[model samples]
Target: MVGRGGVLRRTGGAVVLGTSLLGRLRRRDPGDAILRRAARLTLVASVVFFGCRYGAGSSTLATYGLFGTIAAGSFAQLPGPARRRARILVQSLPVVWALIAVGSLLAWSTWAAAGGMLVVGFVVAFAGVGNPRLVGLASAFQLFYILASFPPYQPGTLPERLGGVTLAVALLAAAEVFLWPDPVPVSYRQRLAEAADGIAAFLDATAGRLTDPHAAAVDRDTRRERAHDAVTAIELNRSPPASAPTAAGAQDRALRICAAALREVLAEADRLAADAPAEPIPDLAAARLLSSCADTTRAAGRSLSPGAPAVAAADLDGAVGRAEAAYPVGAGNARDAPDVPRLCRDATALALADQVRVFAVGCRVATGARLVGDDASSGLFEYARHSPWTLYWWQFRSHLAPRSAHLHSSLRLAVALAIARVAAGVLQLTHGFWVLLATLTVLRTSAADTRTALRPAVLGTIVGAVVSGGVMLLVDELIVYAIVLPVTMLLAFGVGRLLGPVWQQALFTVLLTVVFAQLGPEGWRLAEARLVDVLLGTVIGVLAGVAMWPRGAGHDLRYNAARYLAANADAVDQTVQAVLGAVPPPEGALDRVRRRMVLIDSSYCQYHSERHDPHRQQLNWDAVLSAGHHVLPGAESLLRRNPPGCLAGWPEAAALLRDSAGRLRSAYDTLAEEATHGGTAARPPVSTRCVDQLDRIRPLLGEADLESVRHLVEVDRWLAGLADSLTRISPPAADELVGHRRKP
Candidate 1:
């Protein structure tokens, strides 16, 4: 019912309202404010230009164009490094994009153009976006959209249309830098600091819970969550460019080191359960000391300059001493005691080592020393760049399991896309195209950015589409069409300026759909038909994603725990062999140990993601991993001290080591419960088995070289101390068992 003037007024009013609202919302942060104002201004400017070009059929396009420009411009506000990189990317992207657009234009067929756009989207999403998998998902939907609504070819027309789109994108990208400018570029350092804070807090809380056996599980779970966050933060910088390569590399190393330390802690906790005393130690001074160390580490993160000194040595010594007190001489070796405390201690030590390393790294950064490569030569450096196979297995092994949705896996995304496409075809629902849009909206939503992108995309699409429909309804003349062309340019500019890249795509889609719907042979009454197609695409996308879980990140916690146990078993075998006079550890043995460790780390990491798991698998896995540290070293020490008849009771030592391995394996089996409710109540008969093994080995060590034997005993004592430290960490569910479940 609206006339040309009425529609123009509505658009003008929208511009004014959007601008005003953007200004109010800009107050959240200076960066946000600048971006919003730029977006608003760009939208308004586009409207003015469109109004001058043609009576206003291009108003919607103008708005969307501004949105894209503003969104792109906002990348400039990221932090210096991020902004600089984005600039390079934006500048470089246009050249490639232009080439592709030209190719599509030359092809001139609707399917070709559509397919090209979809392909471009896929490439950009994969290579350009933060995560490559997301690119595949977005590309899949785009493909559907293009297939469903390929423009009918006209002679020599594809090039012109493609040229327009390319030009618009180029202009929008430029506007992102010049008009809507991001105040700060994203900073890897900031992310690292945040991650450190999470880890520090976790360690502090866990340390506080040492004395309270009842609070052990709670502390373990909480720490796991924090550690997971820290690792993710580190992963955020995985794809750093050359600008801050040293920093980026260091950050990566620091994160890995932290993860490794945490793993050691988990292993220690497991050992601690076997060595625990009957009555819980009420005085938690040791726990408090650890908490202090955590606080110091966090406090140090606030000033993230490199080359920072480690936490004061005196404080470190004091904390270590306090933690050591938790493992009384008899506590771990007690006949019926669980080894929880010693495991807790070991996990704490690993955490402390990480904290110290982080402190050192901060000092180095602060002092302008380029962080070095993670090699053996870099003494005490825990910041290795590459993760071990252990971490990798821990990360991907779970994908082997069947699940409805793999939240972070690419396979799930591909399957989802395929399903959505098939479903759309079967439904024969043109109006359901919005379903694809909805799927995109859902796909992008996460704990970090929430739904900020999806909301704008959906809104921009509707606005652009409705405006195109209204334009067709009002003016069907060739003159009107000619006038609308320049107006379209301005609208594209506005959308480019405002909504950003993701929303810009949506805006582009809406504009294209509207233009075709209006100029086609079909009348305005069929507008619903176009909308239906859009909806169908969106629906297909959602259904595809929901049907086959890609990452399978939603499994029960017990599976993750079991994986952790398996990793520990492998680590134990390797560590023992290495310590038992196996120099350089037989080809693949050392590599296997490291690989298993990484797997454990990754498994624990999954627990912290936004996926579905009722029992907090990450926490349980951390505990299990922490527990491994204690048992592994103990098994290794037994071999080292009793190496091939060097000691009076060398055979006894070997037998004892075997017994320990068996006990650990048994405990691993018991803790194999992936689900919260599946844990077995059976305990390991640790003392009886250990005594029998010791009795058998005693004759082999019958005082042949008493002096040499004494030296070996000293080694054993030191090793036991280390093992005892590990044992203070976790209460083994059974006295004799260790929960190692990996198959040899």
Candidate 2:
């Protein structure tokens, strides 16, 4: 199989699996900046650590300096230009000092330390909601706090500790900027713009094929895969540590929604390509509409970046107006003959246009367009338009509830650390921090994730401990130990998480062993203590993960996802009723969808990150989640395309939509109900009812205006999309899954 780096790959599965870590390392690509960054980190560590121990003549300073350096360097997965990373580290000086000081004071007794961990852990983890950069810095802050908290109540030595950390932060910050500086990172906005360009190109190509007789066919699957890749790139890079909040946070946040909107456009375009009618679209106006959509996206792509030309909101509106006018009068053509395939083509084309409209609105909002009259006037930023801190504060405040996965994770970490601290203190473990360290590192958002990571980590730690112990016995010279320390730091910090957590944990254990040994006279018992404390931490972490999810997390995520599904179904009913002139479309539909999307994104992140058990019954979560994402967008698109009183003349067509929506909504309701009550959902019955509704619409299309026809098609397609997705979920899948037993 082809492997990473495209080096040392083997043909057979067995041979490839049999390859060693050494072999893998040999084939590994040590990127230009990473190794230099690691080397720079090593140099800083050596200076701070040895300079403190030998020159200053205090082991406390040495200990804090060494760990502080490590924490500053390795704790966070902060991505960006090196200068940006450096800026974040420099800005962290106050936080680092505060944590260290508080932790030292808390070390007065076991009771204090454990209690402090509860408050400190939650606060640290919870801070991530405001700014994602804090998420990475969280472990570092906690590590520093834990480093200070677990001790012989050495509050007097707090200055030495704080001084060491300050020195380390300064050195690391300098190293990040001046030494081995990282190349400027491509902005996620640029990536989103690029994705927009690709999707737009696909739309253009598809439209040409639809309108022109000689145009070549394009493959839908290839376009879908392309769009999928684009989405992955955007999603992965979008939240990379943001710089100091100016309007930057607000601007960046707007881009994020824009990215989401573009993602929908890609998804819709993919479906449009696949569902294109065999016969060329009879109405060239529909083809022209699709072409206009492509133009809209291209304009969006050009204008998304900060320096790009400012695009007026009216430009987009005018494009839509022109496309609307292009539609031929439906009088003579629709009077005699009913064209079902042609109507379906028109619907598919309109679906693309609807998604494009959403993207257009999103783009305008992102570009700071504040003049669309009503919905687009205040835009997505709304009240927080000028104030980024307000936005950050609100984001933080929103997740305070128990229902939020962010809160759950914060609580989970806090509780786990508190328990671990108490256990370490009561047991009188020599290296008490090791117990907390193990728990902090091993525990994840859920128990299942912890379980997945625990086995390999435990194995790797045991092996590393044995090797470390042997080194301690064999190497008596302090000179040798000092020399090896920087080398180990280089390998551990410089190299990426080598071959998952196994090598990572093992190498880290070894690296720490070297650092600790250099600081003191230790024997094999230190290694033995390390192993014991680590084992204790892992058990507590697993318990904590499970506790938070079902009180462990698996159950909570499913229920959360199910609630979104059920809500989307309700939204479907609302939009359909609104279309039928029964009532205005429900307000806050977008807000509800946005909240659900956020919850699912956070809750299932851990689940999606791990490899699933292929043999077991698992829900088609991707399908369910996609259906959830589409619901609000579909609602908005339907309502936007159909104005008030438009459906008054087409009562039969409106009824057709309402009836079909009832069946579609019922399927989702069943799935959601089953998902909430238990893990299993019975297979939703396939219905001919949608086809019957289409039959009802066929006669109406003959006499309806192009506007009416397009709206009718959009309504049908929206429900049809939901039905197709929901029907794919069955009892055979996710039957043994957990549902939230403790309802929030």
Candidate 3:
């Protein structure tokens, strides 16, 4: 009876697992599932059909088609159909031709080929710096050298090879256009709604944090980051393809306006949260009102989707009115306010009411309600028009400098390839191309990344050899090989996609083994040789990474952080100048600054993922980044509230703000120089002139103008904090201050 129970339990477990797998497959969107399946099936069918038609002599042509299809698939993963088609057609052609030209030259003479390949590797690697498309092209070029090395070198077959690759690219492009194309309008709407929801959630959290001072800082940062990402995504989707109608443009514009307004509201909430009282506020009425506003904003977000009911303007107005009534402006008449706890409560209530008002107005704008007063302009969406050739030339020129990552990578690649070629030739390895392939696949921008890949590459190669040998021993008929080929391709592709670098390498090795097996009878022998070559290549790649350049993502982090600080300083300077009427704001200058922040955030994520740490360096960098994030939104708020004409009456305040901007800019320059050159400069003193001017001007201004001055004070405080943080991280030498102007 016990034995019977164990058998039943095992059967039940197997059934449950199988059902779960099937459920997951069925849960995928039908259109997406069908599209992916069809693409893979089409790739497999084309390869098989061509191989059969051309016979063994033209197997290289079939291999070319397989490679072209894979490359096109990588490009097709871009967001929209039109973009996918353009990238595949234009960006891919030159790369394909360049690969073919280089591979063909190798057939002429060994010495000439070695020299030419070294130069080509260096140039391609350098071109890839800072440009994702160029990096993909570089990989393709290396892949061609690896795969097409042993094919027949007859000049007569060149045209046929080119034609085969071209056909594959065309087929994949067509599939991308017709197969369940990603609908831009729907995606744009969903992304906008998600941004709105993030803003609402942030507001709710701010309110909660006000009531309790022990709220988690990490959670707050994560929410803010997500909100920023959502806004960026909306910006990217703003310009649809020309085929989209005028109405699409209008819809995109409306969404952008909504996102901008929500961003402003979030900035206000962040300020309020930061200034929360030490003692918990017991204002239940104000708390309830804030919660109501959050609920209404969430409903507005939902209404952004098609077929949902729009949020009513009246509902938003009612929430604002209740909040105002609960915490009336200037309600308390106590002169000097002796009770500190009571004053803190009153201050918290006032800030909450102000946030609710701002949020309600933003919600109304998002839902398309007619404004009762002047319509706030979110600025026009400006798109740059540059020809493809011009853009390519600019990329080339920008990365030509010595400090550029592209230049270093290119030089490193050239040296590595030359060494690998020389070593392989001296050893007289029959399959020397495998060494080149391994080196190309393993080496990356960072030593850490290259080292991380080594173990996986070696293990995957061994596993692939064993698997291929076993399969060959089990099956001997051509018909059997044909039947198993598609299944193997599907499994390998699926596993590679689902796993990390380790699994991806293993699957790729497996596919290569299967491909070579079809070429001849000595399949197991070739697999063993391939494994040995891979081991050698990985060692060389790791050594190159360690010995050359050696600086990885951590170095990139410092460079990018310095760039971000410099951009922020410039932004603050420009905003102050515009407000004082010193100079008109450069078109899209603020937007450009915000975009640079996004880029820095991306670089930080990449740096954080690396597996090295200098404890003090990481902590210092984190502090600088945190201070920068706080300064950015505050500066934007000050600009929005204090426009040119509004600040005309406060000349002294304007001058103080200008001086603060200049000091901050100077400090940033010193910081950037220190970060880049590893040489410290004297830190500028923290200025109090802005604070003093704000205090003097506050009593003379009206309620609206007073609010604007308060924002400027907040920005000034943040700048001081930033300067102090930088000083703590890297203090200057006394001798370096000889000619520098000291702050009085």
Candidate 4:
């Protein structure tokens, strides 16, 4: 035996190594370090405790059931208040112990235990079920997981085995709460902040191009969308339990106040854009000011907390102040200089008064000092009465499309899992069943890539199997149990960080398999079989994902671009209308304009990402998008200054404005035709068209509209100039079209 000094040295060295490793993890991300340490500690303690009671091979069936129950619960819940309730239930229930106790008393068969599990699984899946559209889908998946566990090998008493499943859930529930809990509940304030920031960034980037009429219209549409999203977030947060204390409770109250202020601001901006006469406007100081206010509002969003309501309040105050400071008045005069300033001053005061009124109302409700009228709060009724079911199934609605994609994929995945399990049983690979599950879980990308995702799945499984195999060698039961827990925790954390879904799942599966590896040689033999099952499942899942009603990244790229451009067109009209009508734009119009630009930015970023993507299975819309980039910014800049319909009467401004609009429309048509026919030859003559439009508007340079339309004209001029840069291809070579150069 080694000397005591030698043992001490080895123990000291191990401590140093552990400390160094933990320090490294901490440096990577403090949050992750905390999570890993907590997870590891819990796993170690639980494994040791459970091992002492149940021994090496007893709880395999229980563990499996537990995993499935947790999966069903996680997948079924709607990730809000319900998720919290589910967590509490899972933690408090001692479900595994109860199931096993009942099973022992009843002496149920393996299949009977499995049948009972199916019922329990369904109940968990359907618990607190709201949103009917999602219910069927959740139930279907629950069935699949239940069936996947079937036909493997019946545990001694089904009830006893099922009890272990409950135990597994209890462990997970405890992990969730005592481990790093999610800090903030989803709240209106958070949503408002995110939406506001996105719009503000979009506006700043594309502000220079705001003068172009179509671009202005697009900006307006995008802004409206942001407003909608912000409103929705607020509404969701305020639903029932509105006064309950949570992380963002104060922030939610502040967001409600800010949302009202934002709405008023949006209307004002619109009026300004709508009322300006048809002149060649140059500066966009007013629009920029409003955008700055939005930026301030977004900044307030970052500091959301009940204790610091001042951050959000200050933002709302700033937005009101900026709006007051920015609104126009007559030029200063000896007799009336200060009076004109009073007009804006009064407007600012009015906005502040409204904000205070709403705040007091919400405060009364929050503090239980008094109740506020129903009308005092915004977006309350809008969210409560809205049918999410109708919303989910409404295929005609563009906003709802993302949900459909999610639903379709979920169902197909369920079907694939069910089929894979059945195949696994036939192949005699029980562990392979989990390997297949791991593979399915790990595969990423919009479309399933068998080749790319397959490697990780196979590698993870083989590695996990090998690891489990080695751990079995150190079979002094307590030592085996003790070492496995910490190692599994370490492996899980490391793999989760280092790998994508497949590798992560593989790691998780491997850890789980280690826990189950103590089962008789039959279970060990089933490990190889599991690989075959996984391979088969992966094949089925990928095929299902691709076979029917499939969507790829390419189609979305074009749709997003088109939709964004369409919104831009609307924003341009709003701004132009403001200019030509010789009226002050409505409050909040600029906010709407800025929101539209954000959507275009999102589309552009998406397009850029997809263009160079290694997954080249989809159509590349990058070329058209690139051409589009050359045009939109310049257009948006012009619209910002000119405010489409409200421009001052400069010489050729209107004609120039009209001409640019035509060119954009033509370009859009050309792109549509090219996309349809698979060629660019059908595109219109953008250069000649742009040049002609500019020349027509050039004559108005001497007029006041010329000065008013400056921003818009400059943008139009830039677009025309860029269109000239692109080589234009005439379809049928003109001569060929005339049947003179060549015979058809």
Candidate 5:
């Protein structure tokens, strides 16, 4: 009924809107990585599905083939270069085959299927603790098992189903290598190298500043920010793939600790550089120390690459010794008094020497001893060594604790999948896998988090249901459904994440509707069944969430944080004693602290994912984690840096250092106690006390080798960071702990 001009105007507007959308997509997905992936997946899926459905003339083959591509391509989230990803997929085939085989054997009854789901779901979810690649593939593995577990129990079709899956994976893996492959992401070692470079520059710049005190090209605060920024990049970018049970493992923990040590060095440098005179420097000892640290840190960084000249921890040790003999100790007020600017500079320089030595150990562990062989695979990487099963067993054993969110989440997943399987079986739904699919995708760590996402998901499902039902009612051409399926897939899978969870669910529903419509005879009733099954699954997911660990990691954040601090405090105590006796610190000290750190990271990750009540008090968890981060390295620095054991001639300094360690240990214990008992008291001096104590120790240094003061100053720097982090805890009130869960 419209005029030609009117129609032209409307069509022009549609074209403009589409163009705008395309522009936005380009901006959001920069290199079009999402589009590239969507296109690659679409081509592979279309070819596999069509060949099985029309060429092979087996509905089972077609169904498995299509879902196989979805599971592997969309769900697995394989990372790395295309060749590596393909290799990892090839290696995962045995596990996939076992899952399908077990799934077929268990689909005969509700009880068997539900029990299988419970056990299989737990194993797969819990396996993520082993490595990053395993975590990436977990959902795909779960999806495949769920697919074979629901309805039409036919062991006879296992061959076709398995063949179809193999075909899809084989083609997809080949396509991943040959097709438009993803650009290689920045490697973890590369990031570590970059961080080392940043630290080196900062230290070198600080040395220049120390040489010319009054005038500087760069500000101290600015240099510190740049160094910290690099550390942040390493934290965010590095995710080392444990490539083999023994062949894999990146020593990420070591890399992080090393990075932490470097960060500490920069901070200590800046603090000591504060408010000093601009005239010709009274002492070049501090300047030489900075230069040595810069050179040693740079060498360590270079060795992170595949083929760099090897550098040892001994190089750093030698550098410190040279610097110690580089300048004679002052004979005046500056000799023993830290309040004097000259002594303060010297003290700060010693602290840095301690941190750079820790940096050497970090480099050795991360580079697989290719660079520095002194401390490789000892403290952190010792347990995570060369056997895959050994690595897996250790990871598994470590995360088995009751407070681990990984354990709780695994349990929650098992329960939800089991309940969904039971519900689908009892209700006798024709396409029951949809029910399990809903439950698998929708359930969250806590009841509250699951409930938060429920409304949008349910609404999206209803909208999807209506649209799919309308498509079925209004259209009847068989060829039309087939023709549009791949197109729908491209848009759905590619752009879904760009939208929120609502659009993702809605598009997935539309995608499934088109898929099922082609596989068998169906009416609008298929759409009706999907809506009902999703609602049923949603209800089960929420119920299971409530029944299991209803509270997520935030509930245990304080407890775990406190526990972490206690372990770190103990590590410090043990290291100080070992240094005093000049022996290796107890081996168990590193192990306990490493284990606690892993637990805290897990808890912190889950805490962010969970839904918190708006009224609850916000905790400064970053500060707490940062504070805890300083503990082990600080202790290690103390143990490794001092040569003469400071216990001989420097009796007063040795006693003071020993006393300070006890005080820090007590302070950490008190902070842990407060964190445990509602965090009501202000944790004063956890942050600033060590810097203040550094002043007290400076005046008492009575005529000794300047290097003898290194161990105590390093310990103070560590304690200062630890105390600062502990004091930042703003814990929730007593009632807010579980208040969000008690909905009226």
Candidate 6:
């Protein structure tokens, strides 16, 4: 009775769970899924009809279907209608010719085929330098080499095969254009809304952590990751295709501002958590302020949805004002001797209030209001525009150097292809092209990426072979194979998005088996052959990756990290100069600084994604980036503020700031050198002159001037902290130094 009851309970739970999942799916925007299904059906039907009418055999059908699949997949990744069309047209030219040339070479000589593949690998890698489309182009060429190898090499059939591939490309391109005309806009808006929500969630999490030092690290990490992902999504949507109408520019700017503001707020919250006073403030006013700010920011985020009412500027101002008023002013100075705990608490409260004010201002800007108080330029839209061809050429020239990532990756791929060819020849594998295909697909710019690709390729291939083999054994008819085709393709592409490469590859393998089964009677044998070939190729690819350019993503990470720090230091110097009225801030200086921050953030994320490091280098990098984020808005605020006229009287203060800027720049340069070249640069001595100058100028300044001085001091203090963090991580061990003396 007990066992029966347990089984009944389990059955009921399963039914409920299944119903819930179906309900969620039913609620989703079905347009994307419907379009995708239509495309797949169209592709399968076209391939089958053409094959039957022409009696072209299963190989020809498979080739055509594969081309269509590639086109659809690439089209789906593109951001705008215009961009998708342009990519299709441009990518098709090289792909068509490359496939023909590869076929011709294989027909001529095995050695010629190998040489041709090597050249294709190098050219694709080189052309792809900075552009993602070019990289995909290269990948397509490599993939064709593998797929085209299966058919018996015949010179007479080359043109026919090429024509079939062309037809497939055209069909898929048409489907993409007519069936889903404006998918990118809907996707972009959805992503933007999600990003806003992510930022709000992060702010809420940060507020919780301010009072609870023991807050779950997992919660903090999850929120931080979500916020970062949201920022990435927004950045990607920034440069839409020229043909696509821009979304409201102001709203986009507002989203960026909110993201930046949240980053600043989180940084301040981190500082408070790290340096909380031993005795808690009596009123817990700062905590309450944070909680209120979180709620307000979340509400503002929800307002970002399409047609949602804009938040009122007055409401934003009131919330900020309340937070500012709650801060206990002069509490630290009230005692004859400073009470350490009270002073710490008061300082934290004031800083927290300042961050809240910045958040409020950002919220106001997000409501589409013009900047009334401070110069409210976002600097987000101020980017250098370049033509696609010009940008491509520039990237090509830039990465021509030996140390460039593009150059290194191109060389690695070329060498890996050469090796795979030799191994395939020696083994005398019937489908040796599979080895080359696996090598091309699995090899990436870094060993880390290669390893990441390798596992899924092998696993997916095996799973695909096993599953398809089992299905083929049960269902013998051509009609059954036809029915299975669309379902497999949809499952592969749809589930792949959520599960990553594994499911996608497995489904791809299943598709291949189904195509091959129609061509021949030996269905089981073909499946077994595919599994072995895939395993062989994956193993060779992984080995080549380790042996070639073993440093992988780590080298790029250090180089980029160094470059980011150097750019940041330069921005600091520029900001100081502008503030001191020495020279007007260079046009787009802050924009350039923000771009550097983006690069650093991207590189750090890439580094973290590679292999899990026991040393927690990601945490250290995060600290540096957080400090840099604080500097960006601070510099922008400094740029917009009008320095008091009395500042002309204090030449010493101006001179002191310039000196500090130079020192900070020098410190960062040293750090950059250490990161790239593994040698320490000389650290500049910290000067007390800035403090002395501030002391002399403070009493002479009026209230307005006093506030300006306070802002300047805060910038200077943040700079010092940044310098210290860089210094701590810059120097290497004695053995690592070029001129170290060993102990006797």
lDDT of each: 0.42, 0.69, 0.55, 0.41, 0.71, 0.55
Q: Residue 534 error for model 3, in Å?
A: 1.3
The estimated TM-scores of all candidates read 0.51, 0.82, 0.59, 0.52, 0.85, 0.58
Q: Write candidate 1's Cα lDDT for 1-744 as tens digits.
A: 569889999999999999886665454344554345445434543443344224444533443333233333332222253335345434543443454344434334433443444444444333312221222223332422332232233334434333333344455445445665545644555555566576666665555455665666666677667666555434311323321212112343344344334344333333333333344566654455556656656655555534444333345545645644443433234343333333334433433443344343543433334545422221223323334444234333433444211224434333444444344445654433344344444442122222333344445556555755676677667555544543453344343434454445444554454444433455454455555554554444444444544223324334555655555555554444444443333324334434444434443333333333223222233344445443433343334333533433355554555555455555555465422334344232333122232343345444434333333333333334333333332432232121111000
lDDT of 5 by residue, 15-108 (tens): 9999998888888789888888888888988998889998998899989989999899888866567898999888888888889988999999
Which parts of model 5 are misplaced by more than 4 Å?
Answer: 187-190, 219-222, 236-250, 275-285, 305-311, 324-347, 367-373, 376-378, 384-388, 570-591, 605-623, 626-629, 639-744
Best by lDDT: 5
For candidate 4, the lDDT comes to 0.41
Candidate 2: C-alpha RMSD after superposition? 7.1
C-alpha-based local distance difference test score of model 5:
0.71
Which run of 10 residues does model 5 get worst, by summed lDDT?
A: 239-248
lDDT of 4 by residue, 1-744 (tens): 579889999999999998987687667655563355335334633553355336644445535543444343333332333346346446434443444444343223344433444344434322212222232224324433443345434445555454545555555555555655544455544554565565444434333233343456576667656754554343221332222121112223233434443433333333233323233234433344444544554554454434544333344445445543443332123333222222222222222223333333333333322232342333211222234454223312322245233323334444454455445445555454353354354332235343345566667666666655555554436446545755665556453444344555466555665555544444444445555555565666566546633443334444554554444344444444445554454334434333332233223222222212232222233233333332333333334434555455543555555566566556555555454444454334443232344355445534332233334433454444334423232222221111000000
Model 3 C-alpha lDDT per residue in residues 539-643, reported as the tens digit of each score: 888899898877764576568667877876776677667766777753455565555544344343334334443222232343444444434444444455445
Clashes (candidate 2): 11
Error of 3 at 405 (Å): 3.2
Instruction: Locate the minimum summed-lDDT window of 10 residues in model 2.
Output: 735-744
lDDT of 1 at 49: 32
Q: lDDT score, residue 301, model 3? A: 74
RMSD in Å for all candidates: 12.0, 7.1, 11.6, 13.9, 5.4, 11.5
Model 1 alpha-carbon drift over 4 Å, by segment = 1-82, 91-149, 153-188, 191-527, 555-561, 577-590, 596-672, 675-744
Per-structure clash totals for the candidates? 154, 11, 0, 120, 14, 0
